[model samples]
Target chain A: MDAIETNSLGRRFGDVNAVESLDLTVQKGEIYGFLGPNGAGKSTTINMLLGFTPPSSGSGTVLGYDLEHESVAIRQSVGVLPEDFGVYGRLTARKHVRFAIETKGADDDPDDLLGRVELADVADRTAGGFSTGMKQRLALAMALAGNPDLLILDEPSSGLDPNGAREMRAIIREENERGTTVFFSSHVMEQVEAICDRVGIMRDGRLIAEDAIDSLKDRFDADSRLVFTLDTVADDIVPALETMNGVTDINADGNDVSVVVADASRKAPVIEAVGASGVTIKDIRIDDSSLEDLFATLTTGERPTSRHAEENAANTTQLIREADQ
Target chain B: MSWVHVARKDFADALRSKLLWVLSALMILVVAGISAIPQLLYIPGQGPAPGFDDGMSFMFTWMTMMVSIIGLVVGYRAIVGERESGSIRFLLGLPNSRRDVVVGKVLGRATVVAVPTVIGFLVGAVVILALYDGFAVTDYIGLLVFALVIGLVYVSVAVAVSASVNTRAKAVGGVLGIYLIFDLLWWTVPMAIYWLLERELPGSTDLPAWYVLVERLGIWEPLGILSGTLVDIAGVETVSTADRLAGDVPFFLETWFAWVIVIAWVAIPLGIGYYRFNRAVMS
Candidate 1:
């Protein structure tokens, strides 16, 4: 069974539907990145999955247990790093982890869990005294208690430094390697792109896109741009390049030529055609879109400043607005 | 039970606040300090020196009031504070049911009141035994048990208020309003009803059964009835039920029935709190 499956699950707070008709599926033993901008219903969706908030429409299941009715059973085997959670000011790091272990009825040593999160040094110290990064790790240790079959982390690296975020990614990877399904949410695209096996992007309470990173990049690659600085740009070469297969546009200014190709395969032929036309190429740079660009294109419907993401951004913006309506 | 873990965690966490120790000191001063007052004030030439009964009655008056305040202070923040600090996300994110949180908080805060009470009584026993003659062990134990029950009652009320609201301000208002209306001003309820029904205030004795029954609904009324039977000290609220009522005491006014009311004080608020709490969205 999928680790998590929601069908048309939605939630509304009065007139605003914070999350609406979300159909999400995350496979078992996969690291799924739940990405969205703030107020995009990423947190709301996570809240619904963990039974922190009841959905106003449809149904869902986690670990094959009913999301609404069997939340306790689901939580018994699922570990969570909830968003905006505060540590008990009076409880020690060890106590926090111990509390989670005891509630899960798991016999894991609190110190051992704390050690994994790099919190063993301050295990006896009250968590209230810890810095934001330490508190994040402490929360992670508590979430890692019982060696849960599924991990639902809401912005696990939220308060961490780069080093801490890298460590968190490593731990998440380790957990996923142990056959645990890891579902984590973040507004940062880099963190998710680094480790996620699959990702689902939410925008305005809707799942706009879900796929593997490579596939998303491949789909986004349709608008690749190849820029060439030439010794001289022939007037005919501009029209010539535009007429080539997969060449959508060609602009020339002061010996600098830019070619927007419909696919990556068209890049080489366009350059060869220019060379064959006797234009001496001075410099060559190819712009490949990253997941960060993809995220920008998907969520805000805004253009990525990178060379070729503009056309894809316009299309995605049109697609998303239509999907939203 | 899962609640056991929650209670243990809650108690351990509250211990760090030092509120528990402060309460113990206050309780010790009230229980032991007040019990010694009758002896301290006595003189050799006085017509009859103050006895054990004198000291017991002196301290009993203050003990119930202290326990009520301590219960409210400890419990009013038990659940609501977690919400205010965003820590409840950790609480409900685990496998615990909302029932576990409410029930565990009541028991946990009840103990915050109970521990100091036990310490105060233990110390008071030694002081009362040394300073006064004829120390009644069962009577002393009865006072201790009575204090515990009173503490539990208020803690249940405060925790109920905590569970029923999301913000600490609302919890504070709720507990304060409950204490003020029920504990302090409840006596006026029956008096006003008597004034409206009979066109005069209620007299001290020979009143209607319904008049006195309305007074019993006050937070401390049933407990007051209980203190008579629970402690059985001659000097402490010694007025019998029949003397105040116009006729024989009704079954509801009977001391045994007071136990039912006191228990309802504990169970009813928690029931209502749990009903609201279970349906709350953590968002």
Candidate 2:
């Protein structure tokens, strides 16, 4: 069964449709990255799934339990690290996790959970005086209680430094390896791109794109920009490489040449042909299209709330394709 | 049963905040410290040399008042504070139902008020025994139970208010309004009504039964009425309800039925609170 499934799920706040006809599915044992710009309804969807907010329309299930009728059971099985969650300031960190374990009727040791989040030493310290990063870790430790089958984390790395965020990612990966289905929401593209097996992008309360990262990149017609430094430049280098396979575009300037290839598989052929052309290849640096750029393409209204950038990027790719023809 | 965990956690957290200690101190002052005032008033040669009855009558009045206020203070922030600080995410994020939250908070806050109350009465017993002569142990225990029941009543009302509203400001206003209208000024409610209908203020003798019944609906009125049943301290509220009635008293107005009113005071508010809380859409 899918870890989480929502069909035609929607929520409306007053006149605004906060989440409109959202059909989201996260398969078991996969890290599904929920991506959206701010106010894009990602959090709203999470709230509905967790029964924090009732949906205006449609139905859903988490781990075979109905979202509306069986919410308590859903929560019993799913571990949630909610966004904007606050800790009990007067209670110690270990107390927080132990409370969760008790509430869920789980047998996990509180100290072990604290150790996982690197909060073992501070377990006796009150959460009220903890730093933001420490509070986030404590919340994560609580979420790790009970060895839940599915973990729903909203912006899990939001308050952490880069190193802390990396630690969080490692823990999430470790949990997933333990046969746990991880569904986490984030606006940060790099972390999602690095860790998620598949991603579903939301925009204006609707799902616009859902695919594996490489496929999503490919769908945008993102050509890989390979920058190579040559020991010596051949006089006819540009003309000779122009007719090669999968070379979308090539720019030559002195001893540095950059080739935009249509796919990753074409990089090997282009490199072999370039070596045969009598130019010594000094270094190769490949830059695939980042998720930030893909998001800028998919949700072009992300900045300044306009759609012009999306059309421009599409037109640039079309121009390159026509030139190849 | 899961509410047990919620209650335990709430008590532990609030206990560590030192609020319980502060409450314990206040209760001691009200019960033990205030009970000694009657002894001080005794001039040694004038009047009945202020014995145990004097201390019991003097201290029970203050104990009731303090318990009511303390209960409200301890409970008003129980649920709303969590919502405001966003700790409710951890609360509801677990398998906890909203019923569990409301029920657990009431029990937890009730214990907060009860622990100190028990301590205060224990300490006050020693002081009352040493300072006075007619030390009736049953009367003192009766008053102690009365104080604890009053604490539960007010805590239920405060937690109900906390559950009904979404903000701390509203919770404060709710409890305050309830205190002033239904509790402190409850005497005026029936008096004003009697004047409006009967063209005069309600007198202490041969009064309308409806006026007394309206008074019984208040938070303190039923408790006050039941105090007669709970204890018979010599100098405290010696005039019984039957003495002031116009005719043969209705069965419901009897001292025993006041137990029904007290139970309603605790039950009805909690029922309403749980209903409102269960339907709340956590944002």
Candidate 3:
């Protein structure tokens, strides 16, 4: 059975359609990444699936239980770490986990759960003084209390430092390895690409793309750009590289030549073509479109928004200003 | 069962709150001070001024007011406070239904209110027995039960208001409105009704129905029911002028029926509030 299945499930807030006609499916035991930009209906969809908010139209189910009527049963089996959850300031970490255990009727040890989240040392301390990251860890420990069949975490890596985010990824992997279906939502592409077996991207209350990481990269027609630094500029190299199969956009400036190839397999032929021009090669660099680039292309559908693109734009503007001077 | 767990946790958490402790201390002082009124100011030949029954009635009046205030303090933030702080997400993320949340909140806040009320009543009982020469244990017990029921009635009203409103300020304002109307201005309602009838009809020597209707309206007010029930239970005529203005008490004003009204106060608001609470969308 699918871990989560929604058939055109939609929700509207007043006149604003927050989630509209969203049909999604997540197979059991796979870590499904839910990716979206801000205000992209990610939280709204999660809220509807968990029954925190009802859908304005359509139908859905979690673990084969009806979303609307069997919410109690679904909640009993599915653990949720909501993006904007709050801890009781008076309750300690242990108390929070214990409450979840009691609520789920689960026979899990609170100490073990807290220890997994690295919160064992301060298990007795109240959460009132906890930092944001500490609170996130405590909430994660509580969500793991029942050994649930499915775990739905919204922005689980939020508020965590680099090391903390790595630890969170390890925990997600551990949970997924234990035959648990994990539905993780995040805006961090690196984290999602590292752990997710399949991903579904939401854009403006709709699922824009859903596939494996590699498949999504392929579907977007991501290409590799080869940069070569030569001893001298060769007039024949640009035309020679452009005529080659699977090669396009060949440009030479001073001693540097860059070419966009349709795939990595075209790398050898482009290098051979450059060698035939009789210009001595100084260095060669191959820059492939990573998932970050593909994400930018798929989401924004234009110039990549990564730092590299921003730097390139800045350098190009500087060159234009210098020429004017 | 889920509600029981929620209530148990809520009760434990509320017990640790500084606000509950402050209210409990204030109530204890009030009960002690009221109990010592007879001994503090004595008049010779006043025929044993202010015996146990009078002390009990005085304590009931003060305690009723305190209970109303305490009920609002305990219940005004029950549901809306969680929603405002975003903790309702953590709560409803569990296996609990919305009905469970409302039921558990009411039960937990009722305990918070009941604890201090019981303590104050017990201390008052001890003081009355020691100060007065002859004190009936049954009458003291009767007053204790009556006072507790009245306290619960206020608690129900407060919880109902909390559940019905979406913001803490609105919940506080709603309960405060209940307090002003039922505790302070309750008698004016029946008086206004009588004046309207008199103005319209001009001549009605025997207005028994109007009198009965006025007495019946008393059931809606916690203090009215408390005084009426106290009169029947202890055979003490502590009811206010509005009740006696009818010259003869109606059957509905009897002590036994007064108990019914007191219990109904606990039931009716809770039922309506729970129904609305179950249908409300949790943020």
Candidate 4:
């Protein structure tokens, strides 16, 4: 059975539809990425999942327990790192970790959890005086106290620098490797692609796309950026490139035109055609589609336009809007 | 219980902060200074009238005010400060119930407030004995109970205020406003209204019916309990101990409805505060 199944879940705040029809299925031990831009209702969805608030409509089951009837159970079983900094500033790092462990009724040692987060050196220091990254690390340590079967982290790397972010990612991966189901929400596409086994893209409180990262990459055809430096201005080059097979769009500026294509392998043929037109190519580069490209494409309501995801995002957004009413 | 852990942690954290010790010392010095009034202002064994108890009256008036001030300051931050510091979230996020959180907080802070007030009262008692003639055992018991109950009711009211407001500033403002309003209403309003009515109606009329309701309203006020207990200790004829402890009648029915109201004042809001706590959304 899936560790989490949120079916048609929706939430609205006053006139604002914060989350809508967010159907997600995260299997056991799978690192699921909840990708969305800021204000995409990522935090709201996580809040509902953790039973911090009730859903506006729809239903979900977490860890085989009914979301409606067993919310407290779900909260008990799942570990969370809320988007908001939930650590107490006045308390020492050890105190905070110990508090969390005791709250979870887990017999885990506070020193061990602090050690795992690499915060043992500063365990005696007040969290209030700690750096943002240190606080984030402390929050992570607190969340890891119970060895929860399911972990919901909302932008766990938000305040972390590159190294801190890398360490957080490693901790998440290690947790996942230990058979903990990881549900992480992030606007950073590279991190999502690097850490998550599967990805779900949300836009305007809707899950517009969901699939394995590679599969999403394929479905969106999020590959092929045409990079060619031109020797001189070429008239009708854009028109010609637009007419080519598998070419999506061509960006033409003063001295260069970068064409986006469906596949990177089609670059040589396009280069040959451009060269054949007696246009001197000073240099050329081919850029493949990345998670960043996929995120930008999905959030803009562009890439999923011709696929099933466009309708999915639309329907989810509609459901959220209606719930607000 | 988890509340013990929460209480221990709150106490430990409070003890570690030097500000608490500073505040406690300041409170003791100020209260002790105020306790010196009988010696400094009043003539010994004499007043306008020959038999009037000026010392008891002065002690009741000054000590009640001092204890009330202490209760207000110590209890004001119970909820709002915790919420602002994000510490409440850490406490609430645990497996414990909201009742545990609220109860533990109130109980913990009550311990903090009680220590100074009790010590201050004991030190003041010694000063009264040294400087002037001290009271009987009943007076000491009455003053102790009065101080504790006044502190508790104020703390409970403060907790209710804390739960209602979102910020520490608002909470302090709210509790201070409540204290001022209650002080004026319970002490001044009934007498003010009575004095006004006595002028219009002469000897022919009674105190207005609203005055009776307002007098009853005073029973629900914490300051009223403090004054009522003080009066009982200082030999005012409000209610007798025999009437209060009478077992033949149902306890609630036997007492001056004022004591019942005071008990409810302490219990009811505390119940609601705990309920609010359970339902409160912590980050």
Candidate 5:
């Protein structure tokens, strides 16, 4: 059974359509990543799912409960770490967790949850003086209070340091492994690419793409991006690389020219072509377009907004046929 | 119940909030100190505050002022502060309803403000009773209950304002503006109407409509109800012209119209606030 299912969920504020006719199905025990720009209605979709805001039209079911009629029941079974996580400063970390657990009528040790979040050391200290990251962790611990089946996290890493961001990703992965249906949203591509099992990309209040990370890369013709750091000067390489049979696109700054080669074998001939032109190559890197590249491609409107990226990326999956001798 | 759990958390949070505590303490000190001044700087003949016949007279004013100040300070932030801090989303994300949150906030804030008001009233009442040689059990009990209800009403109105507004500063201003406007009108309107009826119409035997309206306003005034009830209960014979005009309207506002007006203020705002809060998208 799907852990979460939204059928044509829509929301509007005055004339601005925050989310329109959005459909989603998240199965149990899978991590679903929601990727979008700052105002692509990503947060609005989550709010409607949680029943914080009633849908302008359509309906949904979370944990088998009606989105509108059974919102309280749905809320009870889900854990949410909002984008801006805030806790009452007067309560200690442990107390905050305990309060949340008690509120949910759940039986879980606050200590265990806080410890998992690495906040047990400051368990007794009031949250008033806590740093942003610490507050975020405390909020996470509170969300985990009832051992909820589904965890909805929005922008979980926006305010964290690099190490903190990595730690949050690890926690999310750990939770997913433990049978939690995770719906995580973020504008940061790296975090979602690293942790999400499947991703849904939203743009302009509509979901433009949804698939596994690999599938999105395969379908979008975006898996491999050709990057080069060269020693010699060759301004014509930019235009020459663009005109190559296998290269779909070319972007160059000075001697460093990157060609999006459709096939991996084209890499050697492209380098040879540069070398034959008396341009020495110092370094060459084939960087696969992770979900980030696909997201940028889809939302930046460089290409038409369609599900075609899925088919294109997958069909071109084979390693590029090398250039002929 | 979930509401109690919410209330407990509110209390815990309020205690931890230095701003709230400092404001409460400052209000208590100012009210208590100002109340005690008449005793310290008394004249031998203008004699014991004209009609200082009872503990209710003094305790009512002290507690009412404190409650209003508390309502303005702590209650004003109940919902708006959560919205401003972006914490309302987290709280609302739980299984609780908007009604439950409103009830919990009002109860929690009332408890906080009531405790201090009760304590201050008792201390000030005892001092006044000892000095004036008057005390009544009815007066004490009535004032305590009145203070609690008034505090809750203020909190309810303030919370509603908080929920509707997006910022804490706006909520504060809204509450203060509301209180100041009512308080000013509570006094000015009645007196103006009384003057017009007395001067403009010579043979008007009955009270003017506008005067009646102003007098009715006194019944619900947070400051007026306590003072008026306490005065009535204290068995004071007659109020002086200045004290009667300056003090009695708030007194009347407290006793006569206090409960009905206060209830309306709380109920209407809370209904609207809940509607807004239920649909608020936590960002």
Candidate 6:
């Protein structure tokens, strides 16, 4: 069974359609990455899945339970770390973890959960004085309670240092290995690319693209560049390389020749073409288009004008006018 | 069961709050101070003297107001404050439903207010017993129960306001508005009604209907219900303020009915608030 499935699920805040026609599906035991820019409705979609916000249209199910009518059952089976959540400031880390355990009706040890998040030493200290990173860890520990079947994390790496983020990724990996389906939203491309099995990119409250990371790059026609340092630059090397299949943007800078290869399959042919030119190859370096670049290219492209966006803008303007009055 | 967890967490959190502690301490001090009034005035108090009853009655009157104020302070931020701070997400992220949150918050705040009220009453009872020989245990218990219920009523009011409003500032403003209307302006309501009726019907000298309306309106306010109940429970014929009104007390003004009114004050607002709260969007 799919861990989560939504059929054109949508939510509107007045005229602002925060999430629209969001048809998404995540398979069991897979780590699905939800990527989007700020205000792109990533959080809104997550909120709808968790039943924190009701959808204006469409239907969904989480772990075979209806999103609207059986939210409590879904919540019981799934763990969440919301994007904008805050801990009870006066409660200690131990108490927060214990509260989650009790709420989930789980047999997990609070101390063990805190230790997993590296919060064992300060478990007794009130969370009010905790740094943002510590609080994030505490929240993660709370989410880990009950050995949840599904974990939905919104910006889990937010407010974490590089080390802390690495630890968080490790925890996700461990949980995934334990057969927990993970759905997490993040603006951090490196973490998502490193961990996500499949990713869905959102733009203006719609799922713009959804596929495996490599396939997404391929679908966008983002090529990998191969740079070669040559012992000698033959006069015809540039033209010959350009004429080769799957090679484009061939350029020569003194002893270095650079060309964009459409995919890994084109790597061998491009190298063979260079050798055929009699230019002795010294060092070869291949640079693939990072997910970051692909993300920028995807989100920054000319967007289709949405009625919701226009209505939202009009509503905002009206609000401003009222405020001025 | 989930609500029990939520309530326990909220109770623990409230207990650690410096503001709650300060308010509770102040309430205890006020009760003790009020109980020591006769001693402060250097009056010899023993047996069933009028002075002893007067002091106890006076303490009950002010204690109701203080407990109501404390209840408002304890509950004004119960739900809306969490929503404003984004902490409600953490709460709802668990298995608990929105109903669990509302119920748990109300119960938690009620406990916070109830504990200090009990402490104040117990301390005041000890002082009253030590100073006056003929203090009735049943009357003291009655006063304690009445005071506690009054506290819960205001807590319900504050929680209702918190649940109904979206913003913390708005919730605080709403509760304060309730405080002003019920605590400060309640007395004026009856007088204002009388004045308007007198002006509207100038020829009618005996406005018995208006008097009955005022008495009924008085039942809605916690202090008024508390005073009337104290009068019945303590077996006092008539309070000084009411003695000048020159009329028999209405049936609704009886003490048993006052208990029902106080209980209704706790229930009606809570029902409306929770109804609205269940449908509220957490965002």
Off by over 4 Å in 3: A217-222, A226-262, A266-286, A300-325, B44-49, B190-223, B230-264
lDDT of each: 0.88, 0.85, 0.76, 0.70, 0.71, 0.77
TM-score comparison, 4 vs 5, better candidate = 4
List model 5 lDDT by residue over A10-111, tens digit each.
999899999999889888988998988899999999888887778999999999999889888887999988776566767788888888898899999999
Docking class of 5: acceptable
Candidates in order, interface RMSD in Å: 0.8, 0.8, 1.3, 2.9, 1.7, 1.0
Q: Distance (Å) between predicted and true CA of B84, model 6?
A: 2.4
Model 6 interface CAPRI class: medium
What is candidate 4's lDDT per residue for A1-325, written digit by digit as tens?
A: 8998988899878898988888889999899999889999888888677665678899889899886667656757777776665455567999888878876778999889989889999999888898889988888888888999998888999978989899999999998988899999998888788878898878899877777887766654534666778888755477777788867667688668877655657777788888887788898876554456556655765536433333233333433344345
Model 5, which residues run further than 4 Å from truth? Answer: A220-290, A302-325, B19-59, B125-134, B187-205, B208-214, B217-259, B279-281
Residue pairs with backbone overlap in model 3: none
Top-scoring candidate (lDDT): 1
lDDT, candidate 3, B1-283, per-residue tens: 7998788888878865776677767777777678678666788777766666666656656766677677777888888788777788888888999889878888888888878877876776677778876677776666666656656677777888777877889888887787677656776776667677676532233445455455455434535555554544343455443444435655565545656776776778778777777667664
**TM-score of the B chain in model 4?**
0.74
- Candidate 2 residue pairs in clash (backbone atoms < 3 Å): A89-A128
Per-residue lDDT over A37-66 for candidate 2, one digit per residue giving the tens place of the 0 to 100 score: 878999999988888899999999999999
TM-score of each: 0.93, 0.87, 0.85, 0.79, 0.79, 0.83
Candidate 6: RMSD to truth = 8.0
The window of 10 residues in a row where model 1 chain B has the poorest summed lDDT is B232-241
> How high is the DockQ of candidate 2?
0.64
Candidate 6, superposed: residue stretches over 4 Å from native: A217-287, A302-325, B43-51, B197-211, B214-223, B226-260
TM-score rank, highest first? 1, 2, 3, 6, 4, 5
- The candidates score, on chain A by TM-score, as follows 0.88, 0.76, 0.81, 0.82, 0.77, 0.76
Model 2 chain A poorest ten-residue lDDT run: A303-312
User: Which fraction of the native contacts appears in each prediction?
Assistant: 0.85, 0.81, 0.72, 0.26, 0.68, 0.82
Which ten contiguous residues of candidate 6 chain A have the minimum total lDDT? Answer: A307-316
Q: 5 or 6, which is superior by DockQ? A: 6
Looking at model 3, residue A50 earns an lDDT score of 83
